[model samples]
Every structure is written in C-alpha cells, then in structure tokens.
Target: MRTTFLVIVLLLMRNDAWSFVVYDDSKIWNQDSITFYFLDGTSQQKNEVKRFSQLWQRYTGIKFNFTNKKPSFFNFKKFYKISFKGKNNESTNGAINGLIQFGNLSDNIIFRKTTILHEFGHMLGLAHEHQRQDRPNYLDNKQLVTACMKNQQQSRAWCNENLFKKFYKKVFIQSEYDPNSIMHYDISNITSKDSETNSNIPESLNNSLSFTDKFYIAMLYNPKLDKKTLKKMHKQDIREQQQFEAKANAE
Candidate 1:
C-alpha cells in the first residue's frame, strides 16, 4: 500500500526536462539595440510582431531597432526571426504557446512572444519562475496527479511523493511568480484542459503603461523611465506575482 501511494505522488510532479526552447539570437540584443528578423510569409504575423515590438519597447525601456533584411543562415545571432510552419513545433494541448510553424515557416508569434520574454529572461540570467525558492504552493498537486494519469497513462496509484515535495517546493521565488506577468499563464488554463483561458485573464501591464495592450512597449523606450524608480517598479512586480499565485491557489 505504501508503494502504491508513492507511485501516485510521482505522477503529480511536472516534468523537469521541459523548458522554453531557445535559439541563438543574442548577437543583436544590446542595451541600445535589439533586432528582429521576420521570415517572409503572411503580413499578419509581421504586423503583430511589429506592434508587439513597439509595445515591448515601451515597457522594457529598450528599443528594438528591427529590420526585415535577410540574415546569414550561418549567423543567426544577428537578429530574432519569425517564420511559419506546416505544423505546430510544440505540444501544449492547443494552447497558443511554444515553438510554432506555419507552411515552411514555424514561427508562432504567440509562442514567439512568450519565447522572446523567456529567452530575454535567460539573457538577464533569471532562472525559471518555478525554480524560485520563495514561491507559494499555488498548484493543486492532486489535480496534477490526475492530469499525469490522464495524459501519460501513468497510474496515479503509484507516485513518488517525496521526490515532488522536495523538488517542487522551490519552483518559484519571491521575484518570479507573477501570474499576470506576461511570463505567467492563466492558472486554470495552464493546469486545466482549457485553451481559452485568455477570455477573462487580467492585464499583465501596470497602470502607468496601461494604454497599450503590450506593457513592454511603454516600459521600455520611455523618456520618463527614470521617474518610476527601480525599487518601486520591481517591488510591484513581485507583489503582483504573489497576488496572482494566491488567487490561483485559492481557486
């Protein structure tokens, strides 16, 4: 009986092997300039990227001096590029996240946006939010256990509780867990089977940069960036993350 209970617990833990897919495009990102490469395809994605870029600049206080010029295939680090694919590049249960492909191109802007921020987070050397040490227990482990059983055909009857308790405990830090963070997902949608959790999701951007849907745009490249003050800025970010996590855990 003890063994069976142990097996059930192991199924609840999220897979550690999974991580945000990163490409080598660090050459262009700098304090003064950031570049994006758009693979020729539909204008919609390009438009979106352009719009998002403008928005991103506003938030990060960084300018993405982008260009549509073709880059050397051998030198990918020069610019961040987007292309479409014939099929999806990731498995997220139809969620608009992860590597994407459309036709010969595999760039999904939804995934691209998330990937960009995640990669940028890496560029900043911020570890995964789940790996943060100050994170509260926001997820329902039992639900995850059931999900593992349903998705992987793993028997919930046999899981390792200790493995998860030790590893999962530090999956978030005081600086990292914002739910409304463009970095985070809707708790229900991220954990549940629903893909449309975006319907009622709150805004990720704060009040000052609230006009544009993209918070990064206003935050970056703003002449008034100095006014906000760094201490208040980062503190608000952490507090918001905690609030979101708390709300999600309650649900």
Candidate 2:
C-alpha cells in the first residue's frame, strides 16, 4: 500500500556571469546530494533505513546524511532537507522537509529491505512505475483499490490518492517498465484489463533494485547522463507532472 506523487519546484543555478540556470525537474531532486534526519524512531528502524539507503548512493552518487543537532529557525532556509517521521510506510518527493515515514518495520528481512528501497525511491524522486500511462493494460484497477483498502487498512479515498491514480501526459510518453522494479507492486490476483493476463503479472517482490532502476537513477542524478539525454527525460517527466497541472486548468 505504498504510493508517491511528484512535487514541483524550481532549482535555479547560475554561472560566473550570474545568469539563472534552470533545473526545474519536478520528478527528480533539485540537487544530487540531500540530507535527512529522523525526528524520532527506534534505533532498529533508523538502522534499517540507513542500511538500505546505501543502494541509491552507490548507484546514483546521491548522498543522504542525517544529523542530531537542530538549526536555528531564524536562518531562513531556501531549500529544505527531509526529516523522516511518522509510523506509516509512506514517502514524499521533493526538497521539502518531513517526507518519509517508516511504518513499523516488519520482521521479514526481505520485506523490510523492500520497504526501505521503495520508500527511498520516492525520496530520491521516483513515482510509481505501475502508474505510468503507457503501462500495459493488465492491471485490475478496481481490484487494486479494493485490495489496498482491505490489506493496507486504507480508505478508498486514500487508496485512490496513493495507488489508483494515473500519472501521465496525454501528449508525451516515455517509459522503462520493469515489473521487478522496487517502485512496483506484486499483485497475484487476476488481471482485469487486456487479454494479456498472466503474461504481464509483475514478478513477486524482491529485495534488490531492478537493473533498470539503477541505470536510470544513475542517469538522472549522476554525471554520466548528458544534457541532451537528461533534458529529454526531464521534459517528458515535466510534461507528465508539471504541465499536467497547466493542462488541467484549461479543461
């Protein structure tokens, strides 16, 4: 019952000439490195997050650090580091503070690893792969909503907000659908869309990041990805997130 949505923000930079450099990618972080802290949590829970968080840093070179000291409120912060709190298994995107919530981590080792990977994926600016518009039509949306409501003990409204909503741009499309992706769910029930059926069932959850996950995350946050390639991907995601807002206004 995990869900994620993008938050739009501008990351303006400048060169020696003092001109603005636009890095307005809503689906990715404004910078490569970010800091986060736990407002309160058990040592075990904090250890779990610290353990699985390394995967992203290893692959994407995005740094995550937490601190124990508090900063003065008078500093007037522009960009904010996330502060993880709450006991729910939810994560939010962007440079805003108070993003991730590590719900009571279950004893299942694999499940614990997967939860951290999944939530950190959102923390690192990834949306639900299953929510992509170009995704195959094998998902049972109604069943998904119902299952989330029951198994996750979530409300219908909460389920829709987190799980069922589509995040896409009608005019632009790009995807790297990996069922084994940490950003995806493993639904064993019947497929309710195209006759594709079981052929498209996402494989059971695993404790590791899919190959595509590492590849793309590196591209998005690392130096290997060129400007042309980065802009192409960023613009499509922008159309998917930011421009969607603009489009919705005219409708």
State TM-scores per candidate: 0.44, 0.67
CA shift at 138, candidate 1, in angstroms? 3.2
Candidate 1 colliding pairs, count? 43
lDDT of 1 by residue, 30-146 (tens): 344445555565677566546534434544555554456875667533334445544322221111112223332224334454544433333322333332333345432446555
Find the 10 residues in a row with the least total lDDT in model 2.
1-10
Q: What is every candidate's alpha-carbon RMSD to the true fold?
A: 14.5, 13.3
Off by over 4 Å in 1: 1-29, 72-77, 86-131, 140-142, 145-176, 193-224, 227-251
lDDT of 2 at 162: 66
Clashes per model (N, Cα, C within 3 A): 43, 0
